[model samples]
Target: MVPWSLWEKLTTAPWLSINAAGQFVQWFNHLLMLIPFGAVIAVALGISLIRRRWWSAVAAVVIPMVAYSLNIWELFIEQLGWWLLIWLISFALCRTATHYLMLSTTCLKIANRCQFFWPLYVGLCSIVIFHPSWLVGVASALIALIPTFICQRLRLFAQLPSKPLEQAQMLGANKAQRMQWVAKRWLTPRLQNWRARTLQQSLLYCAFAGMIGLPGLGQHFYQGLSQGQHAMVGQTILTLLLLQLLLWSIDHAHKEVL
Candidate 1:
């Protein structure tokens, strides 16, 4: 009779082959789905940058959305962390921009800003007080955006005048202006920082989750290693590396914009 270990391996070989084939098919389907959407987004961004025409903007947006009927991009992004990365990058960049504003305020206030500190602190602290949920997160994001958009609209965040402008003339001194400034300076920066840090944190979380048998790329990678799918594992690793590079490029572009 064949050795027990050899027999088990032989028995499972076909199953292993099937699973690998499935994974390859999934990856290819994902690429096919995204390539068109990616192309359209790229084109729209170009036209928007160039012609600045609303119609082009709408066309750029409306045409590629035809992909949504296929829903492949959604599936790929759901598994791939692309959406998460975008959220995090946006949050990080905003937070970084706010840091300078906060620092400036700290010096300028010289005890004056302390009056508003408690409310601001309380508001921000509340976000971290509970376990995160999608509903709560979305509400919080909208609340944050209200002030952010206001600040951008009013140009409340342009650099302070070189010479000390009169406090009375400060654009952001009014209640509305202050709210806008605070939201722009604090909210986006805070969110962006949270996003970037959380994403990096998730690599660890996903690994730990795998150790506990949670399902994800981590679990799949683990299974691949156990079953000796060296090529499959290698491809997964390569895919992860490519994703990181893509995220890095996006961050670099956003940074340049900031």
Candidate 2:
């Protein structure tokens, strides 16, 4: 049976206090990993406008704003430099690698063959390397996502109609031109979907990294459990649940628009 003190602690523990400041910092860092969410929405809005997809544009803007609110600005302001640095680094790496894979059949084949082994690479880096926890966590999430992103894009390419590409080739379009045309027509419309999936998976991996000593809600929860801090454990669980609910609502709204 649980002690009365445990129940009392749970009831009386303050949600915000000097002692909980570290948890708030960890939460901020965790939310920082979501920079991709904002990037995706911004790009989606642009693409929708260019393509004259009015409903898509409205849904893109309104749904995310309603679901996530303007609190993101607070996160950005709190860690403006760090947030921009991480977003730039991650965006550049992902775009370069993805474009390279899309344009090079040889590289695509290699990535496909070795994609399933990415976990080993992540394990090696996390266990053997001596990087900062935030770096390790972000790197691990990116590494873990490589195969998934590759496979999804490959499937997208395969399912796309080849007639347009063939016609472009027959009209003396260069390889780069053909790739650009395909991206503009087929890929741009779907950037939000892809980025949403990436963000969801990234959050999961980042949280999991907490088990390995990364400073986030997952680490906080782990520590709470280890030290038998029931109040902290409950708070962490509640926070995670709320995060999951937010993701679910976004996905649901996205699907409804589709």
Candidate 3:
């Protein structure tokens, strides 16, 4: 058992957040890694599911999406064009994947698609791919999305009414049309259900980023631990746990409200 004195430091308050001005900035920085991945998924869904054409969806999704760069502090205009270009490329890739999923007749065909195979191949071949702290952090959050998306498929099967598809078919809607007009609306609500998990994933990645000093609570925790500042570590962890609880409550309330 640890002595009381050994545990004494844990009782002190951490002053890390006392400077209110930088707190929000720090919080946003922590979530930066998650923003692009979220954008990809959101764009893919909005285009392929709702609008039904990946290319047409590009102009709509991309134009409004440039707004994300506005969230970047102090150089919103100067760096906006570069960020827009990055978003454009990322969305194009994601939309291509959406097309693959939309067009594939069989699961086997999707399994054989190039996107999954090649990125994973490149990710594996480049030894340094997983080593960079920034890369790993982003990858962890994106990986967390895998199970969530799978669950969405299962939820869709259970929740979708076959009668609607039959009605759409009788109304002369093609397979793609029915999926776009009917399935898309049904699937959109499922987005809300993922909020809790997304927050959980974001926090997990933030902690991961902290391992390499990526300017988040994770980094703060790492510093506190290295410096033997148990009190600060305690403060940071408890705050994150509280944030997690807050997110869960918010998600639940959102569902209830909807």
Candidate 4:
């Protein structure tokens, strides 16, 4: 016999009934959860400045700022599937070297020269510290980093250059030839690798977010499981699966110019 948890999730599709109180509660949860994102930005900036690396500061601080300013933040909070898509696009478009640099400087263990532990550094510096909840910021950065390092080490993915076509021109290729080469070789292979890494990282982020009680799909899945909200559980599972399929199909279709 199937376990009750498994049976409920698979068999009991929950109806989207109108729950005004639930709606309000959801909104409030979003607000509370997102307040930390600002701290995430601030700390990233603070770290960059302390390290005297303005480029890192700009990437760590600026991109998320732009995403939030453009209301992409809200989309992620309200719709997990869309949020995953947003992350996918960002990952696909970034320069390979730049993304690796950011990950190394901010998240990975590449630089830890401080004799003091990070907590003590925070204390001695008298800079606003992690408020006990600050681990969320560290964890979020790490969540993005682990796969990035793995990808770099294995060359599992390559980033799209800001101007891949220009390189062909520098080699004296005409416009037509340059375009053909890019489509046939660089663009497609890079896209394929990017898609594979994106899917894997997205899954990692989803799982980590749930473990840490972060907002969006992870939080939703966690709550549903805890409350025995069978319908919500089914919804989250299907949403993640559909996202994976979409990613795979998009990569497949763009195989020529990925």
lDDT (Cα atoms) of all candidates against the true structure: 0.43, 0.51, 0.43, 0.46
List runs of model 1 lying over 4 Å from the truth. 1-215
Per-candidate TM-scores read 0.31, 0.38, 0.30, 0.30
Residues 37-90 of candidate 3: C-alpha lDDT, one tens digit per residue: 355436444544443444444533443344343332222222222333433554
Which candidate has the top score in lDDT? 2
* Ordered list by lDDT, greatest first: 2, 4, 3, 1
Candidate 4 lDDT, 1-258, residue by residue in tens: 999998888665443335755787798887775654544446445655665656655565544454455444553334433444444444454335335644554532232222113223322222123233334434544544554455443342133333456677787878776655554564444445453344344333443333232345555565677799986666555544443343333333332332
Question: Which stretches of candidate 2 lie above 4 Å from their native place?
Answer: 1-88, 123-213, 244-258
State residue 196's C-alpha deviation in candidate 3, in Å. Answer: 21
- Best candidate according to TM-score: 2
Kindly list the per-residue Cα lDDT of model 2 for residues 79-197, writing each as its tens digit: 32333344455446555666666677687667555544444444445544433344445545555566456645655664444447778888898887787677657654554444333
Q: What does the lDDT read for residue 232 in candidate 2?
A: 65
Candidate 1 residue lDDT tens string, 103-149: 67554344222322322332333334422222223343344344434
The better-scoring model by TM-score among 2 and 4 is 2
- Among all windows of ten consecutive residues in candidate 3, which has the lowest summed lDDT? 72-81
